[model samples]
Target: MPAFVLLIAALALAFLLSRLLRLLAQFRRIQRIPVSTVALLPGSGQAAVTGNASGAQLSSPFAAIPCVFWSIEVQEYRSNGRSGSWRTVLARTSDAPLVLDDGTGRVQIEPAGAALFLQDRFAAQQGMFGGLNQSTLDALERLGVRTRTWLSTSRRLRIRERQIRHGERVFALGEIARAGAQAALASTPDAPLLLSNRDAPALARDLTMRMLGLLALPLLLLLAALLIGVFG
Candidate 1:
């Protein structure tokens, strides 16, 4: 009995340790990107109307608003035609600006211009197809080439071609947070950083839970082994 209890405690401890290690790894692996501003948009009325018939408020008013401290991964790939480099930055929220790393500096691309750039760049580069889904592709196509044309004339569309490996995470913040973070940036910072979100506590908690679950896997296996030994 004592051995069994000891084993249980050991399993729990192992699980916790595993979870901690995984969380640490994820934290170290995530790459954060900073932006100058963030904007919020109204949630789609159409989605809400179609989503629920109970009038249960298909979407929260805050759903459309962009929050600070969000993240995405930026991937750069060579154009199929070899005309120019193409970049794909994935975000959970579409209301925010695109991130740009210009070697010497980083900037938040205006949403309109960014959309245009993506549209034109994608269209020009053999339909701009990569990891995008049908919905995303449709959205990009609908966005058209007007804004990108304007941006090309104004800003140098020179993006340094770089590879972003799979599973790399990038972080972004709202305009206010970006401004604050920019002011706080020192010369030769170690890792990329973005503005901290006021609501980050919830996200942190969620991430912690995920890490804990990952840690529990080993414990579960051990328990299964113990149960089989006892029953058999």
Candidate 2:
């Protein structure tokens, strides 16, 4: 049993390493991307831009707050009726196109599968068996909650959502192109697009911190293995 546990632990550690390496690769690409104004990017190839996010300012279907892009998670505090854990009731993201304007020009962004880093625009936790808000109700309708209507009063619902608010400064690194009169940002197979709310320096700082952790991870894992072997 101990050996099995050790093997499982080793596999888990390897999975973590794999994920960290992938993130490191992504952040490396982010660091290499040179930030430019929306006007300076070319019609093709790798391009990066910094600008204010704007578009059809629609309310986030889940959060009901206005923004360019949004992601949301609805969870319920579920338990054995005593002690409990949060269970994800549903999760969704907005696919609406966003525009990035940097004084000189505007570029439309297609956000699917792109690395997006934005701040939370709305978060709330109602008390035990609290009332569901309008946002939650709308989300339920959109998610087809007919069979799950019990969700309304059965659990302690909590909502968490993030969005790139209207006029919020953002960074974009992606494939730039001209679609007729409009410029656009998209991800090519070779170069993935990255969208972030932070400026270049702030993003670089975040990358540096994550890279440091990734760099030290292997050594830490090795040390942990050795310690376990000795103490087991």
Q: Which predicted model would earn the best lDDT?
A: 2
* Candidate 2 backbone collisions, by pair: none
Model 1, residue 108: C-alpha shift (Å) = 3.4
lDDT of 2 by residue, 1-232 (tens): 3999889778977887776776777677767777777777776777788898897777786667777788877777667866888888776777878898999988998887677666677776656545667667666667754313355544466777888889999988888766568989888876667888998777777877876876688689789879988998
User: Which lDDT tens digits does candidate 1 get at residues 1-232?
Assistant: 4899889878877777865775554343232321222222122110000000011112111112222212222234434664755455422222333343323334332222111101011211222342333443344334331213334532112111111111222232222223333311211122222222112343345566777676677679789979989997
**Model 2 ranges off by over 4 Å:** 1-3, 75-89, 126-138, 144-153, 156-158, 211-232
Estimate every model's Cα lDDT from 0 to 1.
0.32, 0.76
